[model samples]
Target: MNIVDFSKEEFQNQQIEASHLEEILKDFRRDGYVIFKDIFSKDYINELNADFIDKYGHLFSEEYKKNVFRVGHRRIQVSVELKKSFNTPYLYANPFILPVLEGIFNTEFIISDLTCVTSLPGAKYMPLHRDGAIFKGVALAPLLPAYAVGLLIPLIPFTKLNGPTRYWPGSHRSPLHSGAFEGNPNFIEPEIETGSCILMDYRIVHCGNPNQSDEKRPLLYCNYSLPWYFDSSNFRFDPHLIVDDNNYSDIPEEYKSLFQRRNMKLQ
Candidate 1:
Protein backbone atom coordinates (compact mmCIF):
# COMPACT_ATOMS: atom_id res chain seq x y z
CA MET A 1 0.00 0.00 0.00
CA ASN A 2 1.22 3.49 -0.86
CA ILE A 3 1.82 5.78 2.09
CA VAL A 4 -0.60 8.70 2.59
CA ASP A 5 1.28 11.82 3.61
CA PHE A 6 -0.63 14.96 4.60
CA SER A 7 1.07 18.30 4.85
CA LYS A 8 0.85 20.35 8.02
CA GLU A 9 -1.24 23.04 6.39
CA GLU A 10 -3.67 20.58 4.78
CA PHE A 11 -4.06 18.53 7.94
CA GLN A 12 -4.53 21.52 10.22
CA ASN A 13 -6.77 23.45 7.83
CA GLN A 14 -8.96 20.83 6.18
CA GLN A 15 -8.46 17.67 8.20
CA ILE A 16 -11.15 15.07 8.78
CA GLU A 17 -12.74 15.47 5.37
CA ALA A 18 -15.26 12.78 4.51
CA SER A 19 -13.32 11.46 1.53
CA HIS A 20 -10.00 11.55 3.37
CA LEU A 21 -11.50 9.77 6.35
CA GLU A 22 -13.01 7.07 4.12
CA GLU A 23 -9.65 6.48 2.48
CA ILE A 24 -7.91 6.44 5.87
CA LEU A 25 -10.32 3.84 7.17
CA LYS A 26 -9.99 1.84 3.98
CA ASP A 27 -6.21 1.84 4.22
CA PHE A 28 -6.26 1.12 7.95
CA ARG A 29 -8.50 -1.89 7.50
CA ARG A 30 -6.46 -3.19 4.58
CA ASP A 31 -2.92 -2.29 5.69
CA GLY A 32 -3.40 -2.25 9.48
CA TYR A 33 -2.10 1.30 9.87
CA VAL A 34 -2.65 4.93 8.82
CA ILE A 35 -0.52 8.05 9.29
CA PHE A 36 -1.76 11.59 9.71
CA LYS A 37 0.88 14.28 9.41
CA ASP A 38 1.07 17.52 11.37
CA ILE A 39 -2.58 17.56 12.36
CA PHE A 40 -1.93 18.23 16.07
CA SER A 41 -0.96 21.61 17.45
CA LYS A 42 2.70 22.16 18.34
CA ASP A 43 1.72 24.50 21.15
CA TYR A 44 -0.37 21.75 22.70
CA ILE A 45 2.45 19.24 22.52
CA ASN A 46 4.96 21.69 23.97
CA GLU A 47 2.66 22.62 26.78
CA LEU A 48 2.05 19.04 27.74
CA ASN A 49 5.75 18.25 27.55
CA ALA A 50 6.50 21.10 29.90
CA ASP A 51 3.69 20.10 32.20
CA PHE A 52 4.97 16.54 32.50
CA ILE A 53 8.47 17.73 33.30
CA ASP A 54 7.21 20.23 35.83
CA LYS A 55 4.96 17.90 37.81
CA TYR A 56 7.16 14.84 37.59
CA GLY A 57 10.69 16.16 37.55
CA HIS A 58 11.37 14.19 40.68
CA LEU A 59 10.52 10.98 38.84
CA PHE A 60 13.47 11.43 36.53
CA SER A 61 15.73 10.56 39.49
CA GLU A 62 13.70 7.88 41.21
CA GLU A 63 14.98 4.29 41.39
CA TYR A 64 11.82 2.88 39.86
CA LYS A 65 12.19 5.21 36.88
CA LYS A 66 15.88 4.33 36.61
CA ASN A 67 15.13 0.63 36.97
CA VAL A 68 12.81 0.70 33.99
CA PHE A 69 15.40 2.47 31.80
CA ARG A 70 17.63 0.07 29.88
CA VAL A 71 18.97 -0.43 26.42
CA GLY A 72 16.10 -0.24 23.86
CA HIS A 73 13.29 -0.01 26.46
CA ARG A 74 11.88 2.58 28.91
CA ARG A 75 8.54 3.44 30.48
CA ILE A 76 6.93 5.53 33.22
CA GLN A 77 4.88 3.06 35.18
CA VAL A 78 1.11 3.68 35.36
CA SER A 79 1.36 3.84 39.14
CA VAL A 80 1.97 7.53 38.70
CA GLU A 81 -1.37 9.19 38.15
CA LEU A 82 -1.34 10.92 34.76
CA LYS A 83 -4.86 12.25 34.30
CA LYS A 84 -4.33 14.49 37.30
CA SER A 85 -0.81 15.55 36.42
CA PHE A 86 -1.07 16.47 32.73
CA ASN A 87 -3.46 17.61 30.04
CA THR A 88 -5.70 14.80 28.78
CA PRO A 89 -8.77 16.73 27.67
CA TYR A 90 -6.96 17.78 24.49
CA LEU A 91 -6.26 14.18 23.52
CA TYR A 92 -9.79 13.12 24.27
CA ALA A 93 -11.33 16.09 22.45
CA ASN A 94 -9.04 15.93 19.45
CA PRO A 95 -11.11 16.27 16.28
CA PHE A 96 -8.51 14.66 14.02
CA ILE A 97 -8.02 11.58 16.22
CA LEU A 98 -11.49 10.92 17.62
CA PRO A 99 -13.03 10.34 14.21
CA VAL A 100 -10.56 7.57 13.50
CA LEU A 101 -11.79 5.83 16.65
CA GLU A 102 -15.32 6.49 15.49
CA GLY A 103 -14.54 4.77 12.22
CA ILE A 104 -13.78 1.63 14.20
CA PHE A 105 -16.52 1.56 16.82
CA ASN A 106 -19.01 4.18 15.64
CA THR A 107 -20.55 5.59 18.87
CA GLU A 108 -19.54 3.04 21.49
CA PHE A 109 -15.78 2.83 22.03
CA ILE A 110 -13.46 3.46 24.98
CA ILE A 111 -9.82 3.69 25.90
CA SER A 112 -8.11 0.50 26.99
CA ASP A 113 -4.80 2.04 28.04
CA LEU A 114 -3.33 5.51 28.09
CA THR A 115 0.35 5.54 29.04
CA CYS A 116 3.71 7.15 28.38
CA VAL A 117 6.56 5.50 26.45
CA THR A 118 10.17 6.62 26.31
CA SER A 119 13.02 5.04 24.41
CA LEU A 120 16.38 6.08 25.78
CA PRO A 121 19.72 5.77 24.04
CA GLY A 122 20.77 2.11 23.83
CA ALA A 123 17.19 0.95 24.07
CA LYS A 124 16.96 -2.57 22.67
CA TYR A 125 14.91 -3.42 19.60
CA MET A 126 11.47 -4.89 20.37
CA PRO A 127 10.30 -7.55 17.96
CA LEU A 128 6.93 -7.33 16.24
CA HIS A 129 4.00 -8.10 18.54
CA ARG A 130 0.33 -7.37 19.11
CA ASP A 131 -0.90 -4.77 21.64
CA GLY A 132 -3.65 -7.07 22.89
CA ALA A 133 -4.57 -10.74 22.92
CA ILE A 134 -4.77 -12.33 19.47
CA PHE A 135 -7.93 -14.28 18.68
CA LYS A 136 -7.91 -18.08 18.82
CA GLY A 137 -6.41 -20.04 15.86
CA VAL A 138 -6.17 -18.01 12.67
CA ALA A 139 -6.53 -19.55 9.21
CA LEU A 140 -5.79 -18.01 5.79
CA ALA A 141 -5.55 -14.33 6.69
CA PRO A 142 -5.91 -12.53 10.05
CA LEU A 143 -9.34 -11.52 11.24
CA LEU A 144 -10.93 -8.16 10.47
CA PRO A 145 -12.51 -5.56 12.76
CA ALA A 146 -9.72 -5.75 15.32
CA TYR A 147 -10.75 -5.30 18.93
CA ALA A 148 -8.46 -2.31 19.52
CA VAL A 149 -6.21 0.31 17.95
CA GLY A 150 -3.01 2.07 19.08
CA LEU A 151 -2.77 5.84 18.70
CA LEU A 152 0.83 7.02 19.05
CA ILE A 153 1.50 10.75 19.62
CA PRO A 154 5.13 11.69 19.59
CA LEU A 155 6.21 14.31 22.10
CA ILE A 156 9.18 15.19 19.97
CA PRO A 157 10.26 14.84 16.35
CA PHE A 158 10.90 11.16 15.59
CA THR A 159 13.80 9.90 13.55
CA LYS A 160 15.60 6.61 13.06
CA LEU A 161 18.35 7.75 15.41
CA ASN A 162 15.82 8.85 18.02
CA GLY A 163 13.86 5.61 17.65
CA PRO A 164 10.63 5.70 15.68
CA THR A 165 8.08 2.92 15.53
CA ARG A 166 8.54 0.22 12.85
CA TYR A 167 5.38 -1.22 11.35
CA TRP A 168 4.82 -3.93 8.74
CA PRO A 169 2.41 -2.46 6.21
CA GLY A 170 0.26 -5.56 5.66
CA SER A 171 1.38 -8.01 8.30
CA HIS A 172 -1.87 -7.86 10.25
CA ARG A 173 -3.24 -10.57 7.99
CA SER A 174 -0.22 -12.87 8.09
CA PRO A 175 -1.13 -16.38 9.15
CA LEU A 176 1.58 -16.40 11.81
CA HIS A 177 -0.11 -13.63 13.78
CA SER A 178 1.21 -14.87 17.11
CA GLY A 179 4.78 -15.65 16.10
CA ALA A 180 7.87 -13.50 15.52
CA PHE A 181 7.24 -12.82 11.84
CA GLU A 182 10.09 -11.27 9.90
CA GLY A 183 9.22 -7.88 8.31
CA ASN A 184 12.60 -6.80 6.98
CA PRO A 185 11.62 -5.70 3.46
CA ASN A 186 8.04 -4.60 4.14
CA PHE A 187 8.59 -2.45 7.25
CA ILE A 188 8.30 1.31 7.21
CA GLU A 189 9.89 3.79 9.61
CA PRO A 190 7.53 6.71 9.32
CA GLU A 191 9.09 10.06 10.26
CA ILE A 192 6.19 11.46 12.21
CA GLU A 193 6.57 14.89 13.82
CA THR A 194 5.24 15.79 17.23
CA GLY A 195 2.01 16.99 15.64
CA SER A 196 1.15 13.93 13.57
CA CYS A 197 -0.45 10.84 15.12
CA ILE A 198 0.08 7.20 14.11
CA LEU A 199 -3.12 5.15 14.18
CA MET A 200 -2.68 1.40 13.92
CA ASP A 201 -4.55 -1.85 14.32
CA TYR A 202 -3.87 -3.58 17.61
CA ARG A 203 -3.19 -6.77 15.67
CA ILE A 204 -0.55 -5.17 13.43
CA VAL A 205 2.99 -6.52 13.71
CA HIS A 206 5.17 -3.69 15.01
CA CYS A 207 7.89 -2.81 17.49
CA GLY A 208 10.19 -0.05 18.72
CA ASN A 209 13.53 0.38 17.02
CA PRO A 210 16.67 0.80 19.15
CA ASN A 211 17.21 4.43 20.09
CA GLN A 212 20.73 5.36 19.09
CA SER A 213 20.47 9.10 19.84
CA ASP A 214 21.52 10.77 23.07
CA GLU A 215 18.05 12.17 23.68
CA LYS A 216 15.23 10.09 25.12
CA ARG A 217 12.31 9.76 22.73
CA PRO A 218 8.98 10.37 24.43
CA LEU A 219 5.51 9.47 23.15
CA LEU A 220 2.00 9.19 24.52
CA TYR A 221 0.03 6.10 23.55
CA CYS A 222 -3.71 5.71 23.78
CA ASN A 223 -5.00 2.22 23.10
CA TYR A 224 -8.65 2.47 22.10
CA SER A 225 -10.94 -0.53 22.04
CA LEU A 226 -14.54 -1.69 22.34
CA PRO A 227 -16.35 -0.72 25.54
CA TRP A 228 -16.95 -4.34 26.43
CA TYR A 229 -13.35 -5.48 25.90
CA PHE A 230 -10.91 -5.91 28.80
CA ASP A 231 -7.25 -4.87 28.34
CA SER A 232 -5.40 -6.90 30.95
CA SER A 233 -3.18 -8.26 28.20
CA ASN A 234 -0.67 -5.42 28.54
CA PHE A 235 -0.22 -3.00 31.43
CA ARG A 236 -3.06 -3.16 33.90
CA PHE A 237 -4.50 0.12 35.18
CA ASP A 238 -4.88 0.15 38.94
CA PRO A 239 -7.92 1.99 40.25
CA HIS A 240 -5.72 3.97 42.62
CA LEU A 241 -3.78 5.43 39.69
CA ILE A 242 -6.86 6.66 37.84
CA VAL A 243 -7.56 10.29 38.66
CA ASP A 244 -10.57 10.81 36.44
CA ASP A 245 -12.43 7.74 37.80
CA ASN A 246 -15.21 8.11 35.19
CA ASN A 247 -16.61 11.19 36.87
CA TYR A 248 -16.10 13.03 33.56
CA SER A 249 -15.36 16.20 35.52
CA ASP A 250 -11.67 16.57 34.61
CA ILE A 251 -11.86 15.46 30.98
CA PRO A 252 -13.69 17.65 28.49
CA GLU A 253 -17.41 17.01 28.23
CA GLU A 254 -17.19 15.83 24.63
CA TYR A 255 -14.60 13.13 25.32
CA LYS A 256 -15.98 11.53 28.46
CA SER A 257 -17.84 9.06 26.30
CA LEU A 258 -14.53 7.66 25.11
CA PHE A 259 -13.52 6.43 28.60
CA GLN A 260 -14.97 3.49 30.49
CA ARG A 261 -13.60 1.63 33.52
CA ARG A 262 -13.16 -2.12 33.15
CA ASN A 263 -14.89 -3.34 36.31
CA MET A 264 -17.29 -0.50 36.88
CA LYS A 265 -20.89 -1.50 37.35
CA LEU A 266 -23.64 -0.05 35.21
CA GLN A 267 -26.16 2.26 36.77
Candidate 2:
Protein backbone atom coordinates (compact mmCIF):
# COMPACT_ATOMS: atom_id res chain seq x y z
CA MET A 1 0.00 0.00 0.00
CA ASN A 2 3.03 2.29 0.38
CA ILE A 3 3.83 4.11 -2.85
CA VAL A 4 7.10 5.97 -3.51
CA ASP A 5 6.52 9.48 -4.76
CA PHE A 6 9.37 10.48 -7.06
CA SER A 7 8.05 13.91 -7.97
CA LYS A 8 9.52 15.50 -4.85
CA GLU A 9 12.17 18.17 -5.40
CA GLU A 10 15.00 15.99 -4.08
CA PHE A 11 14.07 13.06 -6.29
CA GLN A 12 13.56 15.46 -9.19
CA ASN A 13 17.11 16.70 -8.68
CA GLN A 14 18.41 13.16 -9.24
CA GLN A 15 18.84 12.69 -5.51
CA ILE A 16 16.59 10.26 -3.63
CA GLU A 17 16.34 10.79 0.12
CA ALA A 18 18.08 7.97 1.99
CA SER A 19 15.02 7.28 4.08
CA HIS A 20 12.79 7.08 1.01
CA LEU A 21 15.27 4.79 -0.68
CA GLU A 22 15.45 2.64 2.44
CA GLU A 23 11.69 2.47 2.58
CA ILE A 24 11.60 1.35 -1.04
CA LEU A 25 14.11 -1.42 -0.36
CA LYS A 26 12.35 -2.53 2.80
CA ASP A 27 8.90 -2.47 1.17
CA PHE A 28 10.06 -4.53 -1.77
CA ARG A 29 11.92 -6.95 0.47
CA ARG A 30 8.96 -7.48 2.78
CA ASP A 31 6.03 -7.12 0.36
CA GLY A 32 7.71 -8.62 -2.72
CA TYR A 33 6.57 -5.53 -4.64
CA VAL A 34 6.37 -1.72 -4.57
CA ILE A 35 4.51 0.96 -6.47
CA PHE A 36 6.26 4.06 -7.80
CA LYS A 37 3.76 6.86 -8.25
CA ASP A 38 4.36 9.41 -10.98
CA ILE A 39 8.05 8.67 -11.30
CA PHE A 40 7.96 9.59 -15.00
CA SER A 41 6.71 12.58 -16.90
CA LYS A 42 3.19 12.42 -18.25
CA ASP A 43 4.26 13.81 -21.64
CA TYR A 44 7.03 11.19 -21.86
CA ILE A 45 4.72 8.35 -20.88
CA ASN A 46 2.17 9.56 -23.43
CA GLU A 47 4.83 9.54 -26.13
CA LEU A 48 5.79 5.95 -25.38
CA ASN A 49 2.16 4.93 -25.21
CA ALA A 50 1.41 6.56 -28.55
CA ASP A 51 4.42 4.97 -30.19
CA PHE A 52 3.55 1.56 -28.78
CA ILE A 53 0.05 1.81 -30.14
CA ASP A 54 1.25 3.01 -33.53
CA LYS A 55 3.68 0.11 -33.89
CA TYR A 56 1.99 -2.83 -32.17
CA GLY A 57 -1.62 -1.86 -31.69
CA HIS A 58 -2.56 -3.65 -34.86
CA LEU A 59 -2.01 -6.94 -33.12
CA PHE A 60 -5.35 -6.41 -31.45
CA SER A 61 -7.24 -5.83 -34.68
CA GLU A 62 -9.36 -8.70 -35.85
CA GLU A 63 -7.84 -8.47 -39.32
CA TYR A 64 -4.26 -8.67 -38.11
CA LYS A 65 -3.84 -11.55 -35.70
CA LYS A 66 -0.30 -12.80 -36.11
CA ASN A 67 2.30 -12.73 -33.32
CA VAL A 68 -0.35 -12.40 -30.63
CA PHE A 69 -0.55 -14.77 -27.68
CA ARG A 70 -3.60 -14.80 -25.44
CA VAL A 71 -2.99 -14.95 -21.71
CA GLY A 72 -6.67 -14.85 -20.78
CA HIS A 73 -10.04 -14.05 -22.29
CA ARG A 74 -9.69 -10.89 -24.40
CA ARG A 75 -6.21 -10.31 -23.05
CA ILE A 76 -3.11 -10.77 -25.25
CA GLN A 77 0.62 -10.47 -24.82
CA VAL A 78 3.03 -9.19 -27.46
CA SER A 79 6.62 -8.07 -27.91
CA VAL A 80 7.78 -4.45 -27.68
CA GLU A 81 10.15 -2.77 -30.11
CA LEU A 82 12.91 -0.82 -28.44
CA LYS A 83 13.30 2.01 -30.90
CA LYS A 84 12.31 5.66 -31.42
CA SER A 85 10.46 6.93 -28.36
CA PHE A 86 11.32 3.88 -26.25
CA ASN A 87 15.10 3.89 -26.75
CA THR A 88 16.18 5.98 -23.78
CA PRO A 89 18.05 5.59 -20.53
CA TYR A 90 15.05 6.72 -18.53
CA LEU A 91 12.97 3.83 -19.81
CA TYR A 92 15.64 1.13 -19.64
CA ALA A 93 18.51 2.02 -17.31
CA ASN A 94 16.65 4.39 -15.06
CA PRO A 95 18.87 5.92 -12.37
CA PHE A 96 15.97 6.08 -9.95
CA ILE A 97 15.38 2.30 -10.02
CA LEU A 98 18.96 1.06 -10.34
CA PRO A 99 19.80 1.59 -6.67
CA VAL A 100 16.81 -0.37 -5.45
CA LEU A 101 17.56 -3.10 -7.98
CA GLU A 102 21.16 -3.29 -6.80
CA GLY A 103 19.98 -3.57 -3.23
CA ILE A 104 17.79 -6.53 -4.18
CA PHE A 105 20.12 -8.42 -6.49
CA ASN A 106 23.38 -7.36 -4.86
CA THR A 107 24.90 -7.91 -8.32
CA GLU A 108 24.73 -6.62 -11.86
CA PHE A 109 21.39 -7.48 -13.38
CA ILE A 110 20.45 -7.79 -17.04
CA ILE A 111 17.38 -6.44 -18.77
CA SER A 112 15.92 -9.79 -19.65
CA ASP A 113 12.94 -8.67 -21.73
CA LEU A 114 10.39 -6.07 -22.83
CA THR A 115 6.89 -7.21 -23.59
CA CYS A 116 3.37 -5.79 -23.56
CA VAL A 117 0.35 -7.31 -21.90
CA THR A 118 -2.86 -5.74 -23.24
CA SER A 119 -6.22 -6.45 -21.76
CA LEU A 120 -9.06 -5.46 -24.05
CA PRO A 121 -12.48 -4.42 -22.91
CA GLY A 122 -14.45 -7.27 -21.33
CA ALA A 123 -11.30 -9.26 -20.63
CA LYS A 124 -11.78 -11.87 -17.98
CA TYR A 125 -9.74 -12.01 -14.81
CA MET A 126 -6.63 -14.10 -15.29
CA PRO A 127 -6.02 -17.13 -13.10
CA LEU A 128 -3.69 -16.60 -10.15
CA HIS A 129 -0.12 -17.41 -11.16
CA ARG A 130 3.54 -16.71 -10.82
CA ASP A 131 5.41 -15.32 -13.82
CA GLY A 132 8.02 -18.10 -13.71
CA ALA A 133 8.56 -21.50 -12.17
CA ILE A 134 10.89 -21.97 -9.24
CA PHE A 135 14.20 -23.73 -9.72
CA LYS A 136 13.24 -27.24 -10.66
CA GLY A 137 15.05 -30.10 -8.93
CA VAL A 138 16.22 -27.71 -6.25
CA ALA A 139 14.93 -28.07 -2.74
CA LEU A 140 15.97 -24.54 -1.75
CA ALA A 141 14.38 -22.54 -4.54
CA PRO A 142 12.23 -20.60 -2.14
CA LEU A 143 15.21 -19.89 0.08
CA LEU A 144 17.34 -18.40 -2.72
CA PRO A 145 17.88 -14.67 -2.98
CA ALA A 146 15.81 -12.65 -5.41
CA TYR A 147 16.87 -13.64 -8.90
CA ALA A 148 14.43 -11.77 -11.13
CA VAL A 149 11.94 -8.94 -10.86
CA GLY A 150 9.15 -7.66 -13.09
CA LEU A 151 8.47 -3.98 -13.73
CA LEU A 152 5.05 -3.08 -15.10
CA ILE A 153 4.61 0.34 -16.71
CA PRO A 154 1.11 0.97 -17.84
CA LEU A 155 0.46 2.99 -20.98
CA ILE A 156 -2.81 4.25 -19.52
CA PRO A 157 -4.06 4.78 -16.02
CA PHE A 158 -4.63 1.52 -14.17
CA THR A 159 -8.09 2.03 -12.76
CA LYS A 160 -10.55 -0.24 -11.04
CA LEU A 161 -12.66 -0.35 -14.21
CA ASN A 162 -9.67 -1.23 -16.35
CA GLY A 163 -7.86 -4.21 -14.84
CA PRO A 164 -5.08 -3.52 -12.37
CA THR A 165 -2.99 -6.37 -11.03
CA ARG A 166 -3.99 -8.11 -7.78
CA TYR A 167 -0.99 -8.98 -5.66
CA TRP A 168 -0.81 -11.22 -2.56
CA PRO A 169 1.92 -9.71 -0.41
CA GLY A 170 4.89 -11.81 0.72
CA SER A 171 3.75 -14.88 -1.17
CA HIS A 172 7.01 -14.97 -3.11
CA ARG A 173 8.85 -16.56 -0.20
CA SER A 174 6.47 -19.45 0.13
CA PRO A 175 7.43 -22.80 -1.33
CA LEU A 176 3.88 -23.41 -2.46
CA HIS A 177 2.54 -22.30 -5.81
CA SER A 178 0.24 -19.30 -6.33
CA GLY A 179 -2.89 -21.43 -6.29
CA ALA A 180 -2.40 -21.94 -2.56
CA PHE A 181 -3.07 -18.22 -2.08
CA GLU A 182 -6.18 -18.07 -4.22
CA GLY A 183 -9.31 -16.34 -2.83
CA ASN A 184 -7.34 -14.76 0.00
CA PRO A 185 -8.77 -11.39 1.03
CA ASN A 186 -5.41 -10.01 1.96
CA PHE A 187 -4.69 -8.77 -1.55
CA ILE A 188 -4.38 -5.35 -3.16
CA GLU A 189 -5.23 -4.03 -6.62
CA PRO A 190 -3.94 -0.49 -6.57
CA GLU A 191 -5.32 1.93 -9.18
CA ILE A 192 -2.37 3.95 -10.39
CA GLU A 193 -2.16 6.62 -13.05
CA THR A 194 0.17 7.19 -15.96
CA GLY A 195 3.82 8.00 -15.13
CA SER A 196 3.65 5.30 -12.44
CA CYS A 197 4.77 1.68 -12.41
CA ILE A 198 4.85 -1.47 -10.28
CA LEU A 199 7.87 -3.60 -9.46
CA MET A 200 7.32 -7.10 -8.24
CA ASP A 201 9.43 -10.15 -7.48
CA TYR A 202 8.79 -12.66 -10.27
CA ARG A 203 7.99 -15.40 -7.78
CA ILE A 204 5.18 -13.45 -6.16
CA VAL A 205 1.57 -14.62 -6.38
CA HIS A 206 -0.58 -12.30 -8.52
CA CYS A 207 -3.07 -12.03 -11.34
CA GLY A 208 -4.70 -9.44 -13.57
CA ASN A 209 -8.14 -8.08 -12.70
CA PRO A 210 -10.99 -8.09 -15.20
CA ASN A 211 -11.30 -5.09 -17.52
CA GLN A 212 -14.72 -3.60 -17.10
CA SER A 213 -14.08 -0.43 -19.04
CA ASP A 214 -14.30 0.02 -22.79
CA GLU A 215 -10.67 0.98 -23.20
CA LYS A 216 -7.70 -1.31 -23.57
CA ARG A 217 -5.32 -1.70 -20.66
CA PRO A 218 -1.76 -2.08 -21.90
CA LEU A 219 1.19 -2.68 -19.61
CA LEU A 220 4.75 -2.33 -20.84
CA TYR A 221 6.23 -5.23 -18.88
CA CYS A 222 10.00 -5.36 -18.55
CA ASN A 223 11.88 -8.16 -16.84
CA TYR A 224 15.18 -7.63 -15.11
CA SER A 225 17.20 -10.49 -13.68
CA LEU A 226 20.64 -11.45 -12.44
CA PRO A 227 23.24 -11.84 -15.18
CA TRP A 228 23.13 -15.66 -15.19
CA TYR A 229 19.38 -16.15 -15.03
CA PHE A 230 17.50 -16.66 -18.30
CA ASP A 231 13.71 -16.80 -18.54
CA SER A 232 13.09 -19.69 -20.89
CA SER A 233 9.42 -20.07 -20.12
CA ASN A 234 7.67 -16.81 -21.08
CA PHE A 235 9.06 -15.95 -24.51
CA ARG A 236 8.81 -19.42 -26.02
CA PHE A 237 6.74 -18.06 -28.93
CA ASP A 238 7.83 -14.46 -29.47
CA PRO A 239 11.29 -12.97 -29.39
CA HIS A 240 12.56 -11.38 -26.20
CA LEU A 241 13.88 -7.81 -26.00
CA ILE A 242 15.10 -6.64 -29.39
CA VAL A 243 17.37 -3.60 -29.73
CA ASP A 244 17.71 -2.14 -33.18
CA ASP A 245 20.99 -0.72 -34.40
CA ASN A 246 19.93 2.84 -33.67
CA ASN A 247 18.78 2.06 -30.14
CA TYR A 248 21.79 -0.10 -29.38
CA SER A 249 24.11 2.69 -30.38
CA ASP A 250 22.17 5.14 -28.26
CA ILE A 251 22.50 3.09 -25.09
CA PRO A 252 24.99 4.55 -22.66
CA GLU A 253 28.30 2.72 -22.42
CA GLU A 254 27.86 2.05 -18.72
CA TYR A 255 24.33 0.67 -19.20
CA LYS A 256 25.13 -1.59 -22.14
CA SER A 257 25.43 -4.48 -19.72
CA LEU A 258 21.71 -4.30 -19.11
CA PHE A 259 21.09 -5.03 -22.77
CA GLN A 260 23.63 -7.84 -23.10
CA ARG A 261 20.81 -10.34 -23.37
CA ARG A 262 18.91 -8.35 -25.98
CA ASN A 263 18.47 -9.58 -29.53
CA MET A 264 19.97 -7.15 -32.00
CA LYS A 265 20.38 -6.77 -35.71
CA LEU A 266 23.74 -7.31 -37.43
CA GLN A 267 25.89 -4.24 -37.43
State the C-alpha lDDT per candidate: 0.67, 0.84
Give the Å error, residue 251, model 1. 2.9
lDDT of 1 by residue, 1-267 (tens): 335566566566755777877888888888988887666678877776676666554554546565542323553433224443354655754667777778876658777666667665667787667766555465733765767788788888899788788888777777665355663676788877777788888778888888888876777777778866765644542441244455446677666666556333222
Off by over 4 Å in 1: 1-15, 60-62, 65-89, 237-241, 245-247, 262-267
The Cα error of candidate 2 at residue 12, in Å, is 3.5
| TM-score for each candidate, following the candidate numbering | 0.82, 0.94
Q: Give RMSD to native, each candidate.
A: 3.9, 2.5
Q: List the residue pairs that clash in candidate 1.
A: 71-122, 71-123, 71-124, 72-122, 72-123, 72-124
Residue pairs that clash (backbone atoms under 3 angstroms), model 2: none
Worst 10 residues of 1 by lDDT: 71-80
Model 1 scores a TM of: 0.82
lDDT score for residue 208 of model 1: 85
